[model samples]
Target: MQLPILAYGHDILRKQCDEIDPSYPGLDKLIDNMWETMYGANGCGLAAPQVNVPVRLFVVDSKSTHDRMDEVIREDHFVREDTGIVETFINANILDESDDAWIDEEGCLSIPALTERVKRPWSITIEYFNRQFEKQTKTFYGTTARMIQHEYDHTEGVLYLDYLKPLTRKLLHGKLEKIAKGQIKAKYPMQFVK
Candidate 1:
């Protein structure tokens, strides 16, 4: 089932998410629903907070981005030789970040009609539990790493806009306000601030 993604200005989007163990109820179903919601929204990733759940869980499917490189212009510019990963991350933590960085335009399901150029490390090492509760630590590079960092920020109550310059953010203030006022329309179901 696809869930309604919480839009910008939702208080939950600013709160840190809590870690959940395997004992958490409906873990499997929630993960499934998140995937469905993400695909429906045409997003590469979706975090728990985006769905109004304050949990340290997110799903990233860089594979889809990789697959679209043929038709999408410059889509593979930052993607590495690796095909990319499609996996779940629960209670995830970024352990290390490479010195190299790259800039790219990023958009979020929660923040519709907006895309910002953001700079992020080219590679990262993260540790997290998979959906089956198995502990795993892996390093990712290129587009996949950027995708992970974006979703990881949601777990820490941070948004991509926060990385923008003050002037840029100020310029976008009105646009962000419009989204907060529920004046934005998205292809996917969204719950706005009310």
Candidate 2:
């Protein structure tokens, strides 16, 4: 089942998500649904908070992004040969971030119709539990790493909009207000602040 994504004005998106263990109720089902919801919305990543669940859980599939790219674009976009991974991350922690940074346009399932150019590390070393609940540590690079960072920030109560220039955010305030007022149309179901 595809869950309704919570919109920007919702309070849950601003909370620090708690880490979850395998014992968490409906763990497997939630992860599966998240993937469905994400793919249905054409999003490369989805965080639990975006679904109104404030927990250190999220799903990502950068391969979905790669498959859509032209070969020439792919060559310029992917910095790592591995390209990406499709995985469910639980209780994730960023161990280290590479000094190099890249600016990329990103959009969120929760904040529909808004895309921002955000600066993020080109690579990251992280530790997290996989869907099987096995702890794993790995370094991810390029767009894959960018997707992970975006989803990870959601668990930390951060939004890509927060990284925008102050003037840029101010200029977009009116559109943001419309989104918060539930006046925007999205391809998927969304729950907005009342």
Candidate 3:
């Protein structure tokens, strides 16, 4: 079943998610539904908080252009196809010790009408658990890396706008107010027509 996505200003979206229970009832199914939601919404990533499920879980399915292999590989190392797609991360723990961070434009599923360039790490090595409760380590860089960090922020009750400068925030204040009112919607509407 597709879960109702929490819009901007929803208290749940600002609340930190709880650690997921591997054996919890319907946990796997919930993740599946979230994947559907994310794909249906054309989102690069989706967090439990966005789905109103306050659990430490999120789904990241690589799009054709935002492919993980392209971002994870450099001149030498490579990644296998099976390692991407339908990615599920539970109890995600990110190591933000990297001194290398950059700025880029980002959008959120909940806050749809606007996009902003925010400062974020260009690379990350995150440790998380799959739906089967198996531990996994995934490294990301470039756009994919920025995305991982973006969704990971949701798990911690952080929004992309929070990283914006005060001047930028003021410049977009009107649109942000509309978002806070849930009056704005994504220009490209998302539906499960396929």
Per-structure clash totals for the candidates = 0, 0, 0
The TM-score of predicted model 3 comes to: 0.82
Which 10-residue window of candidate 3 scores lowest in summed lDDT?
A: 74-83
lDDT of 1 by residue, 90-176 (tens): 999999999999898899999999999999998999999998899999998888999999999999999999999999999999999
- The TM-score-based order of candidates, best leading, equals 2, 1, 3
Cα lDDT for residue 90, candidate 2: 96
Candidate maximizing lDDT: 1
Tens digit per residue, CA lDDT, model 3, 38-146: 7777777999888877888888764443443454442222123333345778898986435777666688888886788787765678899987899988776665666
Better of 1 and 3 by lDDT: 1
Displacement of residue 142 (Cα, Å) in model 1 is 0.8
Best by TM-score: 2
Angstrom error at residue 13, model 2: 0.6
List candidate 2 segments past 4 Å from native: none
lDDT of 2 at 79: 65
Candidate 2 vs candidate 3, TM-score winner:
2
